[model samples]
Target: MIYIPKMIFHGNPLSFGQYFYDVWGGVSYWFTSALSVAQILLAALFLSQRDRMTFYVGTCTLLSLLGIYLRNTLPSPFPWYYQTGMVSTLLMSLGGVYLRYESRINKLVSKPYVFGIAAFVYLSYVMITNPAHPQGTTPDICMYLWKYLTILCSIICIIALSHLLPQAKWLEYIGKNSLIFYFFSGTMLALFGSITSLLAPDTSYILTLTVTSIALLAATGIN
Candidate 1:
């Protein structure tokens, strides 16, 4: 579908290699994000072994930091290992494993609000100071740092907020179908151009957001 439009409208024919890379090779993170749940379950097998669990988490934490550092420091077009999101999967999956035991950690269970507020504030600070920019072929170290901090902080905030709003059925429904929304979101975004093309070139961001949201929900529902 993507290839046909570029060839017909843009008069730019994408080679098979390019199309494969664009659609699959470069986007391993999209799939790995979901597969990380499998990794979480495997890690849970060691729940009874305290020493091994601590070692695994500690090692993954260090590897996560190392992966971030290497990706930032290395030349453009990072190695397949870095691009495949192995480090990120380990980080997130291990974090999930740790969260299973969070309730037992008296400090975290007792003062969840404090941690949540701190995460919110730090996330706000990063958003303000390190405003996102397009990550080109060779992005800066700050871009890598910004992404890591934003993800970690966002996760913390979401986990904390989940405890407070545990009974929102609407939210639960949305969460249940999040993957469906994710899968079709790009198609909706591409379709959005038809609506935007009818309006002024400099349409407001709100209009784009509104139409995209409606189109995505409609697509999800139809699917």
Candidate 2:
């Protein structure tokens, strides 16, 4: 009802990183190398039998703190995206680990089943409430399908991992924070983008990106 556009074409306005890239000629695309590394590290941590949760939690917290610092001090072209991606991947990875390691034999209802059901319901709600109708450019059907697929994959991974691992408190904590971090990060990006647009209307995209990245980095360092 808030006139939210479909995330595929119009993209989500609340997603600062996405919006920043859209406006700055896609500068953030270059950082995918770093993001890919981070993703791999997180996924590996989840899969490993070693003290994986401890390492995962420490890394996630560090990155999140770094993101906050960067937001304040660095001249990032797309700080929001970087921060959100860092946090999201961490949480998702932790969720996967938790799904693998949490105990269910002692409980009547398993956590993975509950989480899977909840995620499914939420996805369904998004699909039904989506304002875009058939073939609308704003919310392409493929985008919706992709979202569902990602969620499904994540849920399946969690379920499978839970069966394999059987105990990981860090994953539970990370999963709890993931939702909160996602919402807050989106809001922060929108606010930062609006401020930058208003305050530096004539600035070149490169300069803006650089300055923002610096500011974000500095902020992360300080906090």
Candidate 3:
């Protein structure tokens, strides 16, 4: 934003009077601002209402739905599910759903095989019903269902594995640093694009990816 005064725009993030040829480059300022504020409030409510189960669940559900809205309405060329507002809401909703039925869900997810089977089923379904479309929404009900399943299944698989694994100190450490590593990874990715372009094309992509991954890992490792 500080660079906006000088008319500098990279990837043309939403800003006044600056637009890129790509459809994704343009965004309504009011829409973005309103959504951002609403999302922040939703998140705060979710966190502050932690002790009240009913309120927590409601907040979670709202957040998750907000995430869906965020993705579907995003400018084209943007990564689906790329916005933080939607993601926060989605995660909150997931957490709410999980906590609401943790006892019952635990009984089923205790078996690691359940996760394995679920993951297999999800992949198989996707493969069998391969639909050709750009990286955005479709009128097909199956498309939205696929998105829900993919995200839910992944979280379920992770939870199942975590439950099955023996407790380990290293895993605990990594989990603690996950947020720091996540934030760092985004910044490094932006920087890497410019830095990596200077290298020879043949090896640049591979080297860039390798270095980025290593840097991310190091950030997590040392955090």
Candidate 4:
């Protein structure tokens, strides 16, 4: 149903199966990462705390470094879904495990400021040192490292901000239907753009963008 818009406007001729495969295959990395994390959780049941910590830490460091290496070595337009996906997922999963474990042990982890401060420091360093990159590539080693590290830091900061912010019913509503939003996001974005162009062709670009963003959010919430 979502592809109907693409077919009508863009003349996309892909069949349903092709569209599904293309879309679903893009998320296969998450499936792989989930499987790996499941194995780690199962192993954690038998391992001692120290062993679990060491294992998670080791995997996190190795995966981050590997991702940096791959970013540098792999050619542009690399198969990110397969290659970098595993690296990113494993790194994030392990880092999450370590964070959970630490939070359990340390009461200070309950404070959002802890992670918020760390995230700020990491982002500041990345901005100060690795400031420039070409349009489509990360040929610089510093930029490569900055890109991966900042992703982790940004995740931490977002989690911290979520903790710091007061809860809203609208956000909760969106969270409850996050999966629907995720699946429909691309289609809705395209559809919204078409609708904007048709309805308000003379609108300024900034106004069009604002309307499109609001429409996308509203569609996701309604879905």
Top candidate when judged by TM-score against the true structure: 1
Superposed Cα deviation of residue 209, candidate 2 (Å): 40
- Per-residue lDDT of model 2, residues 84-180, tens digit only: 3553555555565556665652242245675566567656656765778454453433453455455655555455556677668856654655544
TM agreement with the true structure for every prediction: 0.62, 0.30, 0.54, 0.58
lDDT of 1: 0.58
Arrange candidates by lDDT, descending: 4, 3, 1, 2
lDDT of 1 by residue, 91-170 (tens): 56457566677765434633767666658767676656654744345355565566666666666666666776649876
Model 4: per-residue lDDT, tens digit, 82-146?
A: 43543554555555575676666244544667787767868686666554833445356667566
Which window of ten consecutive residues has the lowest lDDT sum in model 4?
75-84
Off by over 4 Å in 2: 1-51, 75-80, 103-223
- Candidate 4 structure, TM-score to reference: 0.58
lDDT of 3 by residue, 86-178 (tens): 445555555666777899998887776888877886787566556763354557345655666776777777887788789999778768866
Ranking under TM-score, best-scoring first? 1, 4, 3, 2
lDDT of 4: 0.60
lDDT of each: 0.58, 0.52, 0.58, 0.60
Clashes of 1: 0
